[model samples]
Target: MKVKSVIVPSGMEHLTKFTRKIPSDVNVVPVTNDDSFSNIPLKILHPSKKGRGKNEDSMVLYGQFGLKSFIFMGDLDRRGERQVLQDYPSLKVNIVKLGHHGSRTSSDPNFIKQLEPELAIISAGRHNRYGHPNQETLNTLKMENIS
Candidate 1:
């Protein structure tokens, strides 16, 4: 299938080079916090204010699929996670894409407890240099009974 558009977080200058690399024929749509699509269940959820680092500026998305809900955390660290919880205290999900590749810096135990996700997804290379999928994070998921 032919790719059509690439949606990304807006107002981040660092992404300019990345966006420029996209094929000219494809549409580049930049979205910000709380932005929603018409007739779609997806919505962007990132901190609006500038963060201390690019990782903190990562986008978090919430979407609903039928009776299930999911939250996608894009490289957000503990600080960003705290802010998100403060902004949306009632937020809950059935699935979660753990932030920062399941690094210790991102998945705070409290954050996991609050979300109570049924499943957690950690994307990382098994032999990555940074040693991702930290044991602490795995312990958190296991303690929470998340698969």
Candidate 2:
């Protein structure tokens, strides 16, 4: 499968390892907030407010192939998600991967409502230390009628 990932420094090493394990023929696109790696093509987004001087924490992966668009928010919190929504008001996506393991820090109600995705996937380990898949986040999804 063709894959596009939002590159954040916190997870780059892990991402690189996983991407290397993928089949050679598959296309892997790494979109980042900064141009840290010279070898890989990068799409740099707007800089953060703190003047981090680079794309820090605001990024959402957009995967488009044929007629489908899938959006993945990697560890993105409410602020990051809001930035994305504000930047792209008319954004339409088929699938949404909940950020921060569906923690309350991510998946704001308004953000979820705006996406209106057909499928919402939450990737979190069961009984995680953070108590992920937070009840609040799940309730917000249910309120929006998203399964």
Candidate 3:
């Protein structure tokens, strides 16, 4: 299979280091808030706020497939999570990709309360350094009754 294009958050083109390894014909599409995919139901929820460093500026995506809805929070911190909650007060999802790999810096208790995701996905390595998927975060998920 061949990759056709890469959708990167606007102003974060430098983050796509893998682009150099891809075929020259592949397209790099820069996207901003509220941008929707042509072939999918996903939309960018957070603006690509530059100068905030990488983690804070990570893209926040919301999408729906069939009757299920989900949100992918890209390394967002507590402040960013609060901002997202403020932006979309009614936002709820069946699945959520927890921010910052379930670190204490992200996954605010109130944020999870508001989101009320059925399942929380944390991308962290097993027994790796940095102590990812922190116990506090896990407790928050448990308190929220999320799987």
Candidate 4:
């Protein structure tokens, strides 16, 4: 199967190491603003605007099997999501992996409204250090009727 990943510059080190554990048969596509991995088929979703110093822009990856798409926000903030919405006005997706584990720093009301993804996944270690998936973020998702 083909696998696509969006890696913000700051997360590359960890992601790179993690990727090594995956099977070689999978085709991995990493999207990022870092030129260091330029030779590795990086897709730049936002080029003009400066994203979170480490290139924090909202990225969309189309699934190889179907028309479904997944949007990955590597610690992207509200502003970044807005920029993405503007960049792709007609953007739609099947799933959205919430940025920063649904931290209050991200997930703007309008951004969530626009995305309206069928499923929202927040990748966070259960009851770790930071209190992620903050109440406000959950409320926001509930307000938008997103599960």
Error of 2 at 27 (Å): 17
Off by over 4 Å in 3: 15-23, 48-53
Which lDDT tens digits does candidate 3 get at residues 6-119? 877676665555556667898876677757777866889875454333678778999888888999998989998999999898989999999999999999999999988899
RMSD, each candidate, Å?
2.3, 7.1, 2.1, 6.5
Cα error of candidate 1 at position 127, Å: 2.2
| Residue pairs that clash (backbone atoms under 3 angstroms), model 2 | none
Candidate 2 lDDT over residue span 9-118, tens digit each? 33333455565776666544433444445544333332233332122354556666577677878777787888887777897778888888898998999999999887
Best by TM-score: 3
In every candidate, how many clashes are there?
Answer: 0, 0, 0, 0
Error of 3 at 22 (Å): 5.0
lDDT for 106 in candidate 3 is 95
Shift of residue 68 alpha carbon in model 3, Å: 1.7
Model 4, range 1-147, lDDT digits (tens) per residue? 456543434333345565687666655443344333534432454433333344354443323125667777767777777877787788776777888789988888788888778778898889968989888889988998888
Error of 3 at 69 (Å): 1.2
Model 4 TM-score, 2 decimals:
0.64
Stretches of model 2 off by over 4 angstroms after superposition: 1-58
Local distance difference test, per candidate? 0.85, 0.69, 0.84, 0.65
Better of 1 and 2 by lDDT: 1
Worst 10 residues of 2 by lDDT: 46-55
